[model samples]
Target: MYALIVIISIIFFISCLLFLDYQLGKRNHIKNLRFLDFEPTTGDYNLYTNGDQLFTDLFDDLRHAKKQINVMFFIVKDDDISHELLELLKKKAQEGLRVRLMVDRIGSFRINKATVKQLEQAGIEFTFSSTPKFPFLYYRIQRRNHRKITIIDDEIGYVGGFNMGQEYLGRDAELGNWRDYHLRLIGDVVKDLQITFFDDWYLNTGESYDHIPEPTSEGSKEVEITSTDGGQLEDVFMTLIQQAQDEIFIGTPYFIPSERLMKALLSAMDRGVDVKVIVPMKADHLFVKEAGLPYLSRVRKAGGEVYFFDLGFYHAKVIIIDQELCDIGTANFDRRSLFLNKEVNTLIFNKRFVMDLRLAYLRDVQDSQPFDDHYTQLFNLGTKIRIGLAYLVRPLL
Candidate 1:
């Protein structure tokens, strides 16, 4: 009985320390928080749904870039495709073109120290964004730089879901074909992307870059670049859902939304707005799919349609409202993305582009199966237990 008392006392002491740490972290985060917003800028964009074609065009642009290249991604796996990209960047650096590369410390943990040394030796500026530090260690560690952006010569840019990994190229046996949406853009919007990149670079390293040219319209498409560090995405999503009139189409890998966003979605359905959300049937991480079950069920009960993409992984983060406004970027619909991560998305207000994206969304829907009561009944006892556990700890998911 005396030994048992000692063990219980130790456990209680550790729990108290952890609780204090969490409270401190939360307080520090709120103190330094600032939200971001940008007006719509004109640009020319081409949406790439296939990985092979995207890399092809992206590589060609990188090779032809004359002045500078800025690249950042959440994940850069230590694999063949990543090696290829690194080699290309090194080659470009050798050619006297400025090259800077940044990746999240957590998301690209697979990249070793030797690779970074080689990049530095090749005259490429490299740094890891959002590295965990003291004071608010837990909260800072959880916040990731999830933006995937590339700017070449201050004239061309690429943004969206594709990351530097063989899995993204559909080589993983478990995930057969990778389906995603990315944009290749040219015009004034590239300047906005460059400014965002510069700000991130300065945060990582205390270096600021300037000489950004003035914005000039290159096409007829109007695009707004919306970026969020944290605590702002829920409001953005809610505003979009509230303003949606004719229809709302959402495609994402994870469907775990906050209470307010879920209610907004349900309210939109009540207002006669057609709401359809498509998520992957296969899960990439633990507890993610299960966590979304309750929210998806609520949506279905409110006359909203839910789809399970059966072809492969559906990793696209896109939302189309009335086929007039489209959002495509690195932000997912889950709580972690909506409230924790640093993300960037483009809001495009162009009928032609929205119509094209709508067609692609419909094609993906055709490849999906509906989520109904029959599907819910297929979960086993173990899955049901996991679903309950996931829902309980959803804020961290």
Candidate 2:
């Protein structure tokens, strides 16, 4: 009895310490939040669903870069394709062009010290973003820079879900036929992308560039770049949902939304909006799919459609509303994206672009299976327990 009492006391004391840490972390995060809302700019944009095509165009742009190249990604795996990209950047840097590469410290943990030395030797500037520090260690560890963007010569930009990996090129045996959405852009929006990249670079390196090129219209399509550092994302998503009058379509690898965002989605359905969501049938992370089960079930019950994409690992982060405006970028429709990560998304306000994206969404849906009652009924005792745990620690997911 004495030993048992001591163990209980220890557990209670550790739990209280953790609770205090969490509260302090929350306060610190709110105090340092940053959000940016760029004005709508005219730009020419091409959406790439094929990874091969995207990298081909991107590599070509890198090769043609005249003055500078800035690249950032959440993950840059130590794989064949990543090596190819690093080599290209090294060549560019050696040619006296400014080259900077930034990757998330945690997401790209596979990038070792030897690679950093190689990059530096080649005159390429490299740094890791969102490295965990003191103050709020636990909270800081959870906060990631989830934005994936590239700017070349302050004229061309690439943004979307594609990271530098062979898996992204549909070579992973476990996740076959990788499907995602990415954008290649030119014109005024490229300047916005550069500004976003500069902001992140400044945060990590304390280096700032003063020669941001002036905006020039390249196309008629209107676009707004929204960057968030664990702030204002929920409100942005809520406003997008609340303004929908005809339909809503979302595609994400994770679906664990905040309570308010979920409620707004359901309310959109209640008001006659045709709401649809697509998620992966296979989970890449632990407890993520299970966490979304309850929310997906509720969406189905409320006449909103849910799809499980079985063709491949669906990693597209997109939302289309009323075939009028759409969001596409690194932000997932999950709590981590909506409340914790540093993310960037493009709000495109062109009907033609929206319809094109909507068509692609439907194509993906046709390749998916419905999230019906039978699907929910397939959960067993273990899965149900995981679902409960997922809810208990959802903010961290």
Candidate 3:
């Protein structure tokens, strides 16, 4: 009995230490935060809503590259579209142009060895970011490089949620229509994206390339690029929610938010701020979709509203506040994106741009099916069991 008591005491002590560490870590991140320094340069941003147009524009820009091409994606499937892109990179590399591509290993597990060999034989530099080895495989598995960025000649860049897949083009009949958001930017913002690609490329392959092109004063649109490798992103979301005055509109495919974000959203709703969230009706992961129901229920209980996109899989990560600020990027509302993955998001402070984004959000809302009390009653007993199981393994999802 004495030994049992001693073991229990040790376990309790360890739990206390862990809880303190978690709290202190968050506080440390918040204490070190500083106001973002916005770039004084201007840029032109073209938003692409459909994947067909997005990929077309991306490939066209790649074909026109004169100097070099830097590309990174979370998923690169072994399909016709992937082959087409691979061939384009090969042709560019063969033409004596620098071409480097990085894809997350786990996300692109289906990419066969023959494709990689082809890339190597053609002088195209291809590498996988955050591949797991023998040791610490579990630890490495959770930290994914989720950013999708393409820098063409250091003058033009693209960033958004669209990945390289046939489904992204709405070709998968099961998944149906694929709706997403991507931005093609030309100006100083390109330099910021280039820096992010450089850092990731060098870390993965030990290859170093540094180039920052001169920014052309094209249009007056203020934006800031925020990149996070498993730190401070939660604080960014919390800050944005706190600063919101009138309303906050968030659209993300995933809904497993951190505790602080959940509290902030609930508080905002309690204060009578219009807070609405749009999530995909059919998510890519079953566990994530099941796990998110509770959070949606909590938000709804707090007077906030939730909508599920019925038209297609809404994979865009966007947030707009009071029709004044807009955030669009690769980050999701899940803990993995906020505290584990390498994500990039751009915060735009231009009212006109925000207005356009607001219009887009309105369109999405029109297409979405709002979740009400009736929706909760539709969940059967088996689904509720699955949801409980999903919540138990939420961290991994």
Candidate 4:
């Protein structure tokens, strides 16, 4: 019995040591791979706000994809737009073009098995990222691919907030006029997008291409693609907040923020930077919105402005700083996006592009209402309790 107790104690001690090591490693991981980890290269970027026009451009580009097509999305519903895109992929596959599609299991949970099989039969390769492992269900739920990426022949790419749902194209009655931002990318940065897709693809399907096609230099817009497979995105954002000079504008559907991010935002405001955050008036997820309120409340108290988008379900994950730096991609302003989900964002350091994005944000602001102390009174006791509960599981959200 004494020997048994000693053996168990030794195992417990070793486990504790390993846990401490993991915590320490995770804390320092961002330091090891800072903003400079991903080098900025010259690229041409176009900001697309109209969902109709964005999809039109995407379909047109995909129709012309001669060599290969790669797409990764968090949500790929069985709606008209999704089916249309799938048919296009099928056509490309039948034309001897290598077409690959990946969707997150949870995000695309509603996607029919019949559609997947049809795509497979049509020669289009498809896979689900972070599919559930029965015994490890919690683990599966925590890590998901939330990136919306499409790369064509390794030259052209698209990355941003719009998923494959018809509502994303502004068609839903409940969430009318879906407002979002997607980027049409060309040049050196496209290679990075392709590599990020390749990483998720290989993890899901155990397949990889021979080489990442050599990036062609097209324009002089300097950009860097930062990605986190459940890791460093929040750290990068914190760094960006810390470095902001004059003004910061952030637009996202959900607004839950980490403590570190909250502190950074308050600190930026304290330093005299004009900080404004825009979120959707009609939130798709109430629990998430409620959980975000306390943070927004704190931001308001610190002299930062929080606006509720009144026009539509504003689903844009973007940030513009001092009209000099701009970032847009799949990540949201929530804990799920920061540390739990596989996400990507492109940071562009071009005054011209930043000015365009800033203009777009201002247009959104016109359609939003200031969320002040009065908005806080709208949350009843039950909602406040739910928000408290949601906050506890935020890291796992």
Give each model's whole-structure lDDT. Answer: 0.90, 0.92, 0.85, 0.84
Off by over 4 Å in 1: 1-12, 215-217
Q: Which lDDT tens digits does candidate 1 get at residues 50-110?
A: 8889988998999998888999999999888898899999999999999999999999998
lDDT-best of 1 and 3: 1
Once fitted onto the true fold, the runs of candidate 3 whose alpha carbons sit more than 4 angstroms away are: 1-41, 215-219
TM values, all candidates: 0.96, 0.97, 0.89, 0.89
Cα deviation of 59, candidate 3, in Å: 1.0
Alpha-carbon runs more than 4 Å astray in model 4: 1-37
Question: Order the candidates by lDDT, highest first — what do you get?
Answer: 2, 1, 3, 4
lDDT of 4: 0.84
Of the candidates numbered 2 and 3, which has the greater TM-score value? 2
Q: What is candidate 3's lDDT per residue for 1-397, written digit by digit as tens?
A: 9999999999999878655654554454345433233354567789988999998989999999999898999999889888888899999999999899899989888777888998989998899987865333454566688999998987888999999989999998878898888999987788888878878888788978655666554556778888887667888899899999899999999999988899999888878789999999997877888899999989888888899999978898999999999889999999888876888888888998899999999899999998997888899999899999998777666
Task: Give residue 85's error in model 4 in angstroms.
Answer: 0.7
Clashing pairs in 3: none
Could you tell which candidate, 1 or 4, scores higher by lDDT? 1
